[model samples]
Target: MYGNQWSTDGVVVARNGPSLVSYRFILKRSDDGKLFKCEAFDSEGESILESSVILEVFYIPKISFSPKQTLTVKENEQAQLICINDGNDQNATTIWKRQRTSTIVQNNCVLNFKNVKRTDAGLYTCIVDTKVGVYEDNARVIVLYAPTIDIEYFPSTKTMKCIPRGIPDSYMFKDWEHTTEYNDHLRFLATTKEGNNATLTIPQNVNKKDNNRERGIYICRASNNISSIDGTFAMQKYNLNLPGKPHFVSSTENTQYGIYLETTEIKIKFVSVPENTNYVVYKNGIKFTDYNESVLRNTKIIDTMYGKNVSVKGNILSLFVKLYTSEDFCWYKIAVKNVVGCSNYSIKLFSASLPGIPQILRAVPKQTEIAVLWNPGFHGGYHRWFIIEYRKVGDIYWSNQTTNSPNSTVIGGLQPVTIYLIRMFSRNRIHDSKRTEEILIQTGNVLMQ
Candidate 1:
């Protein structure tokens, strides 16, 4: 009886009851399949005829949130968000916005992030708007980046935890190690890296052999199995140690084995144990305390060493040594001393000498010129060659000529029957040898006589 009438209601007058009846109700998308009916009853109210209409409703569009409520990706990697929508409104505009800001990020059902970054992490809202109504939903975008491992010391708990800045959920703790000397002397420490925790408890209850085990540098690391950048695997240095003695450290390839005079210099760089280290240089077997000048020659001494120059930038002792004479080449040394102990180093230098004199083999005289053949003597640990000097027998002025080979040279533009004194010698970059014993020769008219 509630508004299911046909053609009339109470059958009074046009204004009150004789008006035709109709069914009227608010329609919505949910009411699209609802049925409405009208009935006409007989005079005795025994039989009735009914008419019905199934409602068809049209409404605005509504979008469904993507299945991935939260997403994670590495920096510079591609990522996207999809919003599935269902509605009858044809021109529905979908907009994606960062919930923290009023700016719209995307203008479609799919929100695309071609290159995701750490800053893109936050709640993103997808809004679908029709002319009649608007529908919106939110999803979280979690951008995963390279795991940055940082060591956090907890004094209260007496432990240090390796915390990853990026998505820790995806990263696993590798291990904790003592990197005091890097990998060569590396010792893996006991850590709480069983599950997701990366922590190290300073060893307290240990035997004598494990004394100061917690000293030196400590490192904790984590990784997400993906290495896209250099910082993907982090290695931090923490200096935790007791005082140590000074020592020398050598690099992989060092050319300071032997020192040769006038041509080379040596530089040694190294890091010693922390604290004030006193270095004393030695010459031969004597302590090189002050500068000493060699009147015979000038020699300079410079201090240099090599070791793990890390941790502390050890005190530098630079000595520049320039020795001009062969006698200046000798044993040099470095003495490193601290409160703990002393260390010493020594090096020997060899000197190069002038070449030896050359010997004349034979002489051939022409009408106005003469040629001399000679053999070069030992180089005496230096690069050298032969040279010839000659002059007229009675003249004091001498003429010199360089040998084409170590064994030959020529002297021309001479008088035909004149006597000449000739000699041969050797010369190096540093010095020249004494001339050999002089010999006399004569130039003749017909071929040399």
Candidate 2:
């Protein structure tokens, strides 16, 4: 122990015997130095032994907000935040940071903002340095402002989105209401919140329960401890007035036609539509205007081999041909469009100048021959006859037969249990049509007697 200069307060000393001694004292703030010492003397009072020890203390750093306890400021106004620290170390540092961003707003003890905006509204933290370690405390900086709303509607999805902007971006604390003035109550379909923005969505469908309501409007009211704001927007539904696509019903002449020197018109029927809706006719994907007017309006003969006409009346669309040419031989497409939009084209309509392929009705295998029934399509331009050709499946040359009747035919001298290929073509004085696709048939075996 030190000499009599050492204070007796909070200090104790004990001696058990001639060679044992102990000293104790409570550590204090001023005792944080290495100057404390103990000494023992012999009978001569000379310095026998001496010792010294240093004292140190550890503690948690104290942190505090400078301006006030409840920190609230108006939006777009000047503001400041000061972090006051009370500790033993004078070289300690202070930092200020916001919740959403990692950018350190201030490194010193004070943070200053010229104009505080709504984005600055959030939990702010003040960090203080201490001898043991760094410590942090949080304080809320609330910026108050009126709510703003931006609305967008998508027609195809039938959805409307309303985005609300304000302080305290929480959907639970806000009141979302949708209504129509025509005594119809609308529904808030869904709500989503991300970052500082909250969005409310509603469907664009009309309320069938209320007959007079055609539109819906959304209103949102939001509030924080500082202030309250409200926003509203009206929703509209887009209407499409275009009619559906037109379809081919029945044609005066079937899709295929026979080649004839005489002028003939083909009358066709189409699916009906709204009388006011206009239709655009296309030939092989090309607009009908590309052809001569006479070819599209009414039939007029220019020469023995040339002219064409196309016309539309109510639900019936017709095509007139005075001569056969490639321009008049193709498909037709009809589409309808109105104030709203255009509809897709109907199915294609085929027109051919040559004889159409023949269809087989029935084939009867007999004892010595096979009886086949058929029908000829268009004969080009005349009541031309078809040349029926058939042969065994492996035969290179086809057996031929002529028929003015065009419906049924029989081939004799065919072996039983044999397969044959049959095809036919129409012929006239001007041109010969291509052969039709081949049909296959097998002959039956003879019955046992």
lDDT of all predictions, in order shown? 0.64, 0.56
Q: Each candidate's TM vs. the true structure? A: 0.48, 0.33
Q: How does model 2 fare in lDDT?
A: 0.56
Clashing pairs in 2: 258-380, 258-381, 259-380, 259-381, 260-381, 295-308, 295-309, 296-310
lDDT of 2 by residue, 58-141 (tens): 456677886964477887789887887766676777888786567788998887878888777778778777777999888788
Distance (Å) between predicted and true CA of 294, model 1? 18
Give a tens-digit lDDT track for model 1, residues 1-449: 22226322323211111224654546778776666555654556533566666755657665666657777667788887898778766677889999968998888888888878788988999888876678888888877666666677775555787776666466666557664433323467777864555778876533422222344567776777656455556555566544445544443113232234443443444444444346777777887654432121111212222222323233434455666556557777877676766666665655556778888889999988888887787776545777788899879888888754777767888888888999878887667899999999988877554
On TM-score, the candidate that comes out on top is 1
